[model samples]
Target: MRHAYTVETVRAAERTLMSRLPPGTLMQRAAAGLAAACGSLMHGTYSRRVVVLAGSGDNGGDALYAAARLARRGAGVTAVLLTPDKAHPGGLAALRRAGGRTLPPEPEAADQAIAQAHLILDGIVGIGGRGGLRPQAAHLARTARESRATVVAVDLPSGIDPDTGETPGETVHADATVTFGSYKPGLLIDPAAEHVGALRLIDIGLGPYLPPPELEALQHADVAALLPTPVGETDKYRRGVVGVVAGSERYPGAAVLAVGGALRGGAGAVRYVGPGAEAVIARYPETLVTSGPPSKAGRVQAWVVGPGLGDDRAARQAVAEVLGSDVPVLVDADALRLADRDQIRRRTAATVLTPHAGEAAALLSADRADVESARLAHVKQLAEAYQATVLLKGSTTLIAQRGHPVRVNPTGTAWLSTAGSGDVLSGLTGSLLAAGLTARDAASVGAYLHGLAGRETPVPFGAHELADRIPQVWRSVHPRT
Candidate 1:
């Protein structure tokens, strides 16, 4: 798992680590790491032009010290000090000693240096920065961006909320970012993630002091450990059975797509109940199909309801029966509209609710924009409101369940915005739940796999194609003998 720490936790760890070391030791370690990264970005350090956007505080100190190192290595380094008087005195003295020149914060000189530079280091604002950049810094940042210089941000890009990844105003766009101590939430999530072209985390010995991660993105190894493996004693029924209640005559493809996802979700068998039984049988003859309600769909380990299920009388009744059953349930799409809030809240078995921003907004009676803007907050709220695991799908897919750490999916591309994708996701998650994973684990793993499939699938591909790629990714994560 790739863990992200909040600013507070990072600061605390830095302080604890710094307390035990000599006064300037930690900063020197950080500067050395920064300078090394800068060197690698260049063809050679000798006679190369490097510009450092040195602003207030230790972030500027880091930039200035790293610039001094570059100057000593024969790079023509210039420091554009945003706060000349308040700049770190040690850093300034070292730069001057190493023959580095300083330029006052003037747009003309700044732009010229930025335009001619081989590299630009952004230290105008650090992780503590909030809102947008000041005029002088923003202008220099804009110039650097317009130039061909390879821009590297110190810590994080200027003008992003380090904690929440919210870009309220103008932010620096960097070719790469070198963060110190630990990863900040902003560098890992969008719309700020878009600003961070490439990310490199430089450990300054702050790991032991840091607390538990505020956010975590699972990697392949973590997903591998969580995936279910069949034992010698396992039979088809023992492996698990997933019951899918989806589709209508108007949109029979939803049933086909959902069943496709379930088949690859490690389920021993899939029992499908819906109006699209004929279409499902035609496509997946292996599926046990019935034109009956979910309750009468034989024994199933878990139930997936609501994909392409219109808000008609039969759809409403199907949702009610699924909720009333003692088995785990995953509700999605049109079922989100017809399902009773109280019925969902009162369910005893595990429940996973997957909603896009619009559906989440409807559930909370808030604007879609609001839900999209504050996804982390809204996803948790929905999980609590319905007393179910909630998966809010978007640029950053989040899975939240009450009393559990909200998981952000790092996989996936914008291409996943195609239609019927959510249906596949719902079925995949339900199958995992049937495989005996908790609601939270099922939702998160399903999202991770689904997003990986989206990334593997060709662009402009349909939802069915996305489903077809799931098994490839699953095998890649953990291959069966």
Candidate 2:
């Protein structure tokens, strides 16, 4: 798993590590990594035009010192000080000693220097920064964006919520970010994740001092370790059966897509109970179809409720019956509305709720825009409210549950935003639940695999094709040995 520590935790770790070392040893270590990355970006040190947007803090010191290294190697480096009087004194002196020049934050001077530069290093703000940039800095950041230069953020992109990844105001868009020590929450979550184009993590040795991660993203090995594989004695009955309650007269395709995902997502058998029985049977003849409530759907290890289920009496009854069952349940799409909160919180078995921003907004009684802006906060809130696992799917798919690190899925393509794609995800996650993975693991692993399948599927493909690619991606992760 790739761990993301909160700003407070990271700051604490940095402080602890710095105390053990000499006064400037930690800063020098960070500068060394930043300089190496800047050198590589320029491709060659000689005659390279490098610009550093230096502020007044350690972040600025790191970038300025890095620029000094390039200046020593024959690069013509310039520093555009946002606050000329408050800029890091040591960093400024080092740059001057190495033959680099400095410029005030004048539009004409900075504009000309930035336009001619091959690379720009952003050191305007550090991890504790919130709200947005000051007027002058924001304008300079805009100009930097307009430049042809490759912008590299020293730690994270300035003017972003380092913990929440929310952009309250104008923020610099970095082509690449060289983060030191540990990964910050903003570096992995979206809005800010969008600002951070490509990412590079440079270790300055904070591992021993760091605590538990605030958020995590699963890698292939982590998912593979949690995969439920069949043994020599395992049969179809022993693998696990998933019960799917989805689709309606209005959206029969939801049933077909969900069933497709279940079969391909490692479920031994699928017991489908819904109004789209005929449609599901036509698409997946192997599905065990029944026209009864989920309670009478003949013994399933877990249940996936909702998708295209409308707000009808039958749908409510189905939701209630599923919620009443002893097995774990995954609620999605229309079912998020139909399922009762009290009933969910009362359940002993695990409950996973998957909601897109709009649905999550409805559930939390907040604006869709707010949910989208601070996805990290909203996801955790919903998990606490429901007392169940919550998966907030959007630009970044996040899984949140109490007492565990929030999980952010890193393998998604924007193309996966098409309609019915989430139905496939619901089924896949439900199957993992039946396979006996914890609610957090099921949701995280499901999002991981589903995102990979989205990338694996060809462009302009439908949800059906995305589901079809699941088994292919599954083999890629847990290959036959």
Candidate 3:
């Protein structure tokens, strides 16, 4: 699992580590790591030209010191100081002592150096800075960006709000970022994440002081452990059954897609009940389809509702029945928008609400922009408010349950944005729930599989292609025994 700490957590850890060590100890460790990363970028081209964009903070100190190291190793290094007078005094002295030259604040000089450089180190700001680059720094950064040089950010791309993962103003676009200690939230989430090209972590020994992370991503091995596997003594009924309530006359394809997803999922049996039974039967004759409501349908370990059920009275009735049942419920699509919070909270069975940005905004009575800006906090809040697990879908999908750390899904691609994708996800997740995975586990595993399936399909895929590739994803993640 890849854990991401909030800015406050990282600050606290830095303080604790700083208190125990001597002054300048952490900075030196950071600079050393930075220098080593820069050397690797040189790639046997020690005679390459390097430009260091220095600011007034510890971030600039790291770049200046790193440039000194490069200069000593025969690279022609030049530091373009945005705030020359306020620059780290020790770093400036060290760079000069190591034969690195410094240039005053001149746009022409900065432009010339950047154009001729092989690499540019952005030290204009750190995690502490906010609201993008200052005007002067922004100009220099733009010039560097236009150059052919590979830009390396010192800690984070300057001008990005590290905690919120939003780019507030002008920021440098990095070819790669060398972060200290651990991964920051900005580097993992989108908008700001897009600016951070490739990422590399340089350990500075701050792990002991860190607390539990606010969010985590399940790796391949982590997914391997959570997947459901049948034992020798287990029969179909012993494994688990998933009940699906989806589709209507207006959109019978929703039922077909939902059943398609469940059939390929790791469920023992799928009991599908809805008005689209004929359509579902036509596509998947093996499905045990019923025309009655979910409550009247035979017993099932879990229920998935609202894939294609429109705002019709029958769809609402099906949703109400699923809420009243004693089995876990996975809510998605139109059902998500029509759900009653009070009824959802009153349910005894485990409930999972999966909503995209617009749906989540409707649930919270807030705008989509607000939800996107504070995604982590909103997902957690929804989980607590409705007393159900909340999976907020986006580029960086987040799954949070009451009293548990939020898990972010990192495996999705832009190609997964096609129609009926959510229905497939609902079926897969509901199947996992029926197979006895916890609400959180079911959501994360489902997302991982859905993303892997989307990746397996060629880009620009239709929903059917995404559904067809689920079996391949399952095999890749969990080999049959």
Which candidate leads the pack in lDDT? Answer: 2
Minimal lDDT window, size 10, model 3:
37-46
Q: Which 10-residue window of candidate 2 scores lowest in summed lDDT?
A: 258-267
**Local accuracy by lDDT, each model:** 0.89, 0.92, 0.87
Better of 2 and 3 by lDDT: 2
How well is each residue in 337-428 modelled by candidate 3, as lDDT tens digits? 77778999999889999999889998888899988877877888889889999888887788999777788887888888888888888998
Residue 53: error of model 1 in Å?
1.4
* Tens-digit lDDT track of model 1 for 394-434: 98888888776678898999999989999899889999999
Q: Could you give me the TM-score of model 2 versus the true structure?
A: 0.98
Candidate 1 residue-wise lDDT at 227: 88
Ranked by TM-score, the better of candidates 1 and 2 is 2
Compared with the true structure, the alpha-carbon lDDT of candidate 2 equals 0.92
Local lDDT at 454 for model 2: 93
Candidate 2 residue 208 C-alpha distance from true site, Å: 0.4
- Deviation in Å, model 2, residue 251 alpha carbon: 0.7
Full ranking by lDDT = 2, 1, 3
User: Whose TM-score is greatest here?
Assistant: 2
